[model samples]
Target: MSIIVQEQTGLFHLQSSGMSYIFQIVEGYPVHVYWGNRLKHREPMSDLLIHTPKKAGLDRLPQEYPQYGSGDFRNPAYQAELEDGTRITELKYAGYRIIKGKPSLTGFPAVYVEDEAEADTLELELVDAYSGLQVVLSYSIFSDRNAIVRSARLVNEGDKKLRLRRALSASVDFQGTRDFEITYLTGAWAREGNITRKPLHQGETRFDSKRGMSGHQFNPFAALVTPQTTEYQGDAYGFSLVYSGGFEASAEVDSFGSTRFNIGVNSFDFAWLLTPGESFQTPETVMVYSGQGLGELSRTYHRLYRTRLCRGKYRDQERPILVNNWEATYFNFNADKLVSIAEEGAKLGIELFVLDDGWFGKRDSDNSSLGDWVEDRRKLPGGLADVAGRINRLGLKFGLWVEPEMISPDSELYRKHPDWCLHVPGRRRSEARWQLVLDYTRQEVRDYIYDSLSAIFSSVPVSYVKWDMNRCLTEIGSAELPPERQSETAHRYVLGVYELLERITTAFPDILFESCCSGGGRFDPGMLYYMPQTWTSDNTDAVERLKIQYGTSLVYPASAIGAHVSAVPNHQVGRMTPLEFRGDVAMSGNFGYELDLTKFTEEEKEIVKRQVAAYKEIRGLVQKGDLYRLKSPFEGNESAWMFVSENKEEALVYHFQVMAVPHPPQRYLRLAGLHPELEYEVQSGDSEDKPIIGGDRLMHLGLPLAYEQKDYESGWFRIRAVNPGKA
Candidate 1:
């Protein structure tokens, strides 16, 4: 049996007459490889040979090359690495046999030497193709040393426009219904429940109780189960990303015995229509392997997702915990007011000061102006940068908020360019908040937004952008595109918005970008491509946020949320709570204070002072920590969770009292992490009272319930046990 292996790991590589590597299964899972080496510039064949894994029936595979019977080419330079550690850098068209890399397809274990041969013996057969309406059968193999992962491109070289539905189904000859779990990092971790038992394992299982069947689809994991073809008559199907191919990785995972795997996407999905030789492109990939369990498979999958597929193209940076002022001061604060809040914020360790909506346009409040990206002159005598500079000079970074795709009817942009709105040019245009949506699908729209933002960033010391999308698709239709192209509106709108963001980010790679569509509306991997973090929601109430934040964190890292301590009588839900309760709730996230700080009474201000102090002391521990929910919101009267840093040096626990209970014995709480054999002293965050306790106190004795929660009040107990050595 022969296998193929490629050892080079370049972000992008150029090639002639071949598909690019979108997803490469290295050992047993897939890894991402940027394959667009400046298009049209091909490279000399490197000693790169892609390898196949080793298995029983698939051991002795012959090296095979595709014979071009349909096209006029004697031979194409093929690359492969054999099951042994040797690489095959050249290929000659033989009769019908091609060596199997990893049995990417099922049938053959040997690399084929045939130029062209009968279809029966081969595991995968290219059944049909022409004008982008392509279909085929495939297998997942990883048993050969030197092999060929397939790559196919269907160009729209026909005369009339054609409608097409494309599908590629895998018919792996597995012994039985292969058992595998399909997990997704979607819905956030459950907010309210009894602390869940540690999953039988950590890295393998999803933290949520909500599980679905299908196969883990990537981060937005979903099994491509049975693919269905869509029919298209005109431009609706003009362009498609439908293509598929196959390949395998080294049998044993690098320097380690575990196998690493990657898949190629030059071929496998999408249906496209062609018009008189106009071309449409589709990419594909298929991978197969025999593995012990998902643990190995997941390790391979995660690396590929992060290294290659995460296209935002930025190194991992600590996501900023920003507080937008719109929700805090509304459109009412002046430069001095803004400055005062920021100064207090900085003293409390806030990182960035964001100016939200109503800071632009010819008016005030949420109703008047959106399309106007200019800094509101009435709001501040100086420009936007002046305020940003003020915040920056105050030892904090500055962030600006923009609703680029929205325009209010009362604004200048709509009055001058009514045609740019989404409705029919004649019929009543839909208006919410007396605002119309921008035609982000158009290039002109993108250019205008790009230049305006570029000018702002250039003029100020801006380091972050709170990219917010407030509304969903209300008025669906668009008069701009042709009738057949209307369905492309939503998808294209998203993609176009992404394109504009992509351009902006490329231009200003240093600026951190965040995406929020009314809080999690566009919360998918697609948006994460450009914006690393997102505003978790419009709801900031501590009680309500317990679930929202918990659910959101299950899939996204904790840093993604723009959490803050809003004023009591919660803005969204008018329930007033203590300031301490509010701060403790927001502390678990990218902590920041949002309420107008100066308005508080002297007593309230002191609480604010202590709250800020608490955050400062534990911010690092909270930011870089492992979260374990000690009590699930659903199963208990109260919610309790603990945050432990990567190092066991520090720990903070948040216990929220949801109900009134009778005073009982000593308060006992069984904690998840602590040295089972070590002893240390424990005390409340503010109290100097000493209570030298042992792990047994936390694990066996547990803290008893002694007090009841005030109707709207909450409790936060910070625990720091002295390390025995340090003591």
Candidate 2:
């Protein structure tokens, strides 16, 4: 069993091969004992808990799920108000049960186990006798991964109403803080997922998003690590909220230098009213402990999320090489123009052609016709069926883009039901990209979207759907929600989106869905639960993607990133890059193209053909292999990364140079994650010369990089073990 409980000592220990989380019930409160490298179970393990004099109180002791107004002066995991307006409540340990398998959070996305033996869950119950509020803290430890999934459930067992003001998912109190540093991802629009790191300080350092959607500004993730920690070594603790809506993750250092880390739904402008017998479940937060370092922590998350968190028919399948017409034509293409692009894509080995924006209503630009899902007769005289059929006949799958969550005032749907959008009774309704957010909190609104999208999916042979939301939420109000429940609008709106996604994805099991919120805005674990992959970013500039994709790979798997090659001067950054460099960058993820294939020259067309073929040959390895980042783009002008298969039989290495220098010093790039005893053969891009070397020498001595004269030069290498049995 992964979970072991010492009944006599009231201690519980959750263990994985690489880590352990231990806590004990003292007097009445559950005190955090230790969370770090794994330790053998013993009777004396209970001694690890520090016991202070009664007068010292919990302020000096570590707590598990600490509550406000209790003895603890630090931040609490949750806070609530009673019917009498009292906010103070003390909870005492009740009882706990060991469950065979992890239980799913009601109406929330979380990691799951296919078999009962894959994980063990411990449910620790605490009760506030004064208010009859029961809080159940669940901790599930995976048998094969160095991670723990934590969540809390608040049940109003009393006859009165309970208003929760702050409810966070998980919290941990680390004994010392001065030695720790915080690492998180932050950026804007086209530059999402820029890694930021800083030393831990006296006050709280927070990462949050209050823009309704998980804004592109800050991701819902944070990590506390030793200052000496590097990508390949040192202890690291990572926390990630499995939510796509507004969220908060923070690290607070008390005067005593103890750090309390918490992560969950943003408590800002948030509240939930729980009536008698009603329960509120917080979103799950994944906690990973890596004594081996950040790289192992990331690999654990990559393997777990790719195999367990993401679910669908396409979860384990090799994604199709697609060509989206957004950058190619934007809002200006007709049926003939689309069919021509699809023909060109098919000739160059692209498997799918996506028709993006402007095919519906009278949509010529981003200004109008968003709510109407019907095709415009002027753009496609024969509707979706005709174009899809043409593309299908040319041996390419057909894809369509839709922004189902937005409504343009000029559209017929919005005109018919102006009240359908989220708006206050008297406040002005804000418009972004000339569109308003639909009130998903209303069943009718969700039904309307589902029906509209269902009609298109049923009528056409759509192989994929690029579900996009172009703007962050504003004027957050819902007509269907009562005044007392208005504070719940944002969370309910996210739930409604999930409800609609569940219905559609479950209904059409064969169609592939790619979630996009202006690009990487909504790229989160919650969205990945329904859609296995996400459009990495709207920016197709290869040079800019070095930082974006590199930072993103810190947590997200390559299989879940939708990367595409685009035309030069790139539409987003207007920086011209070599076609080969663009292809190399895009091939590191789910490969695709977002350009007008018909406009390519004969030579460029041949290059694209070879790029497509090369991606096909390595797509399996690239998507499923373990990634080892050799060089970071943030550290220097050059970047290098590689992927090694699970069995260590095959590997692919990619290196990029942003700018060239004259007479640079000789440097050899050392590789990692290979069997030292095995002999391997390495082959550079399209080169006839093959070199055989031992895996030990490849990792220790490294490979020599060929110097190039121009900027934006990139290359890839393929490696295969020559003696598999010997290794």
lDDT tens digits, residue span 49-147, model 1: 234445421111111112122331222112112223232222121112233322221211111221222111222222122222222222222222111
Q: What TM-score would every model get versus the actual structure?
A: 0.62, 0.99
Q: Rate the local accuracy (lDDT) of all candidates.
A: 0.47, 0.92
Lowest summed lDDT window (length 10), candidate 1: 231-240
Q: How many backbone clashes does every candidate have?
A: 126, 0
Clashing pairs in 2: none
lDDT of 2 by residue, 203-264 (tens): 89888999999889998888888988988899999998899999988888999899999998
Residue 219 lDDT (model 1): 24
